[model samples]
Target: MEQHHPSLRSEALALLRSGVTNREVAEKLGVPRGTVGWWLHEDRKARGVVVAERPHNCPRCLSLPINRPAYAYLLGLYLGDGHIVAKGKQNHLSIYCCDGWPGLIDDAEDTMRKVLTGTNTGRRAKIGCTEVKSYSKHWTCLFPQHGPGMKHQRRIELSDWQQEIADGFPWELVRGLIHSDGCRFTNWTTRMVGGKRKRYEYPRYYFTNKSDDIRKIFTDTLDRLGVEWRTLARGSDPYNISIARRPSVALMDAHIGPKY
Candidate 1:
């Protein structure tokens, strides 16, 4: 950085405080653009004005084009297992992935970056899982479901734009939801077939969520995709949505297999 006269900085600050753009001030004063920006920043700091970082390029707010499929998938993951923390100096969207599935962790981070282009993302290791986090103040703007309580305890509903994306990319949403809160496993039973004992294996998919609204969202999407799902009661609460029909299971297998 080149040193400049104190009087030049004073003149730059005067221009900046008077609504002159940094570039314009730099151009009029023959100062470098970077120096003008730095001076303006310093002036604001000295005057007790908090200099916020450049605003994130929010697709919804800016009417900017976004990767809809990626957004759809990330939304599902968020509804199923991710959350946003917006507080003093602590704002981010975090999706937790089981450590056993390193690939899913990577995919979660990648999908977040894709949706929030050029955003900063990092990971934190937790017991039995890793939290893939994207730092942004606009996460709540993107995911309106973020609120003051647990998702299951709150009413979760997507906005019109989100519903449109989910409709367009139903499979991706299903994949993300399954990767977060659903699982595929094989159930075996022995049966007598023509006087011979035979073992039969049935592969099924299950999505478990305590939130009625989230469950409805999942089931409604399944209905739109022509895939059948049934509710299975666990103890007193029916938190499991099971896809056991051969055709439905096959559809799920074709679209969203076991997590990698």
Candidate 2:
């Protein structure tokens, strides 16, 4: 015998819209209880509504609808502490690196633009080595010119600039820049490839008992540079510093110099 009929379907839909229990509606319509559930499911599917089995919100998932900033923040957290491995010898971590602020040239003019008018919503605000090269050779040619015939001078110059930039950003920033997400200032070290020696020091910056001093130092530098920055302290432990602009080797060398 055919169970489903137009009258039963209409009654089921009406009962569902009226908030009647599926079992009640099934009994009233002389159909199995699952029939009501299947109808509701099909209705939702037809309307393109995804009803998650567990109906709770994940902040990380919800953040995407708001803005890219929220999305990026969620992404950073995900990259930082989201996953784990079981019995794997190698620890895999990923970090973000912007080669250059694609559209923004790394000249005084572009810097001025950034200072005056901030970046757009989707655009990333940072000076990359690639963008730096296009505008001026100041960063690329910091050292004394050696020979008359400089065949591959720019490439060599760029490598030097890269190293300088890498060194300038407090080792913490350097670590973050190189390894986009996983690298932390505390308890993280850089070692030489295939060697036992540690190439760079961990906990690059010192934090004293005085909280104001740390805030002052960070704020003063940012104010002088006309840049925006934020620092979050992890329960009186090491703090994480995030800046609007990526550290430039040329600028760092000029500002802080070798002593810093």
Candidate 3:
């Protein structure tokens, strides 16, 4: 067996005692599975937690009570461009994002793994789209918005736990939505100032989604953060939201700058 750090052993044991399985504890703590198994076996000998006594299902796969920034971000991504499908005892969660964006795929994978403690991988699905997929037994519980049809056709609402997370860290939710389906860039204009023409460029954030409910969730979170936004054509079309002012832009910069 490879020599391992004592901290890794401690982390693995902690996670295992907190209900994570040996496999999940190893991957989560960046330790070898065999090491985790040995550690847990030793712990079981000490505390009497045995394989036969273990739940047939993995506790980490069950309903997660984490309401941190990562969970809020994943919730936003799901609302924007993710899909959760029930597949045999697990819910497969996949979020499609722009492949050209900087560090988006990497960030999504990291955030999901941190929040759900699950194995995740990203793949190129199309010309400009990448999908980050992970399996968890509690995805449906986390994102109750998942349904038979499209998000717009169905009501997109947050669960009570999701509401708690969004209310606390609305910025993370905004970041995930913007990273997945929105963009921020400089908008320049030229006008007469002091009887002379001057050019100025300002940063603005734009979020466009086909689902009104999703857009409302984004805007509502922004509202909670006191971020200003304008709706161009309400109920007319998607991509109708824009935040083009200074203070709002500055706030967003502090919270949800370019993911990289």
Candidate that scores best on lDDT: 1
| CA lDDT, every model vs. true structure | 0.92, 0.37, 0.79
Instruction: Please state the error at residue 128 of candidate 2 in Å.
Output: 72
- Clashing residue pairs in all predictions, respectively, total 0, 4, 0
Off by over 4 Å in 1: 1-47
Q: Report the Cα lDDT for residue 52, model 2.
A: 53
Q: How big is the positional error of residue 12 in model 1, measured in Å on the Cα after superposition?
A: 26
In candidate 2, what residue range of length 10 has the lowest lDDT sum? 131-140
**Residues 172-255, candidate 3, lDDT per residue (tens digit)?**
888889887788889999999999999989999988887878888988888888999998766656557899989999988887
Candidate 1 vs candidate 3, TM-score winner: 1
lDDT of 1 by residue, 29-79 (tens): 999999998887777787899866766788877889989999999998999
Tens-digit per-residue lDDT, 57-135, candidate 2: 2222333222222222222222221221212222211122345322222222232223213221122244442211111
Q: After the best TM-score superposition of candidate 3, give how far the Cα of residue 148 lies from its true spot, in angstroms.
A: 1.3
**Which candidate ranks first by TM-score, i.e. highest?**
1
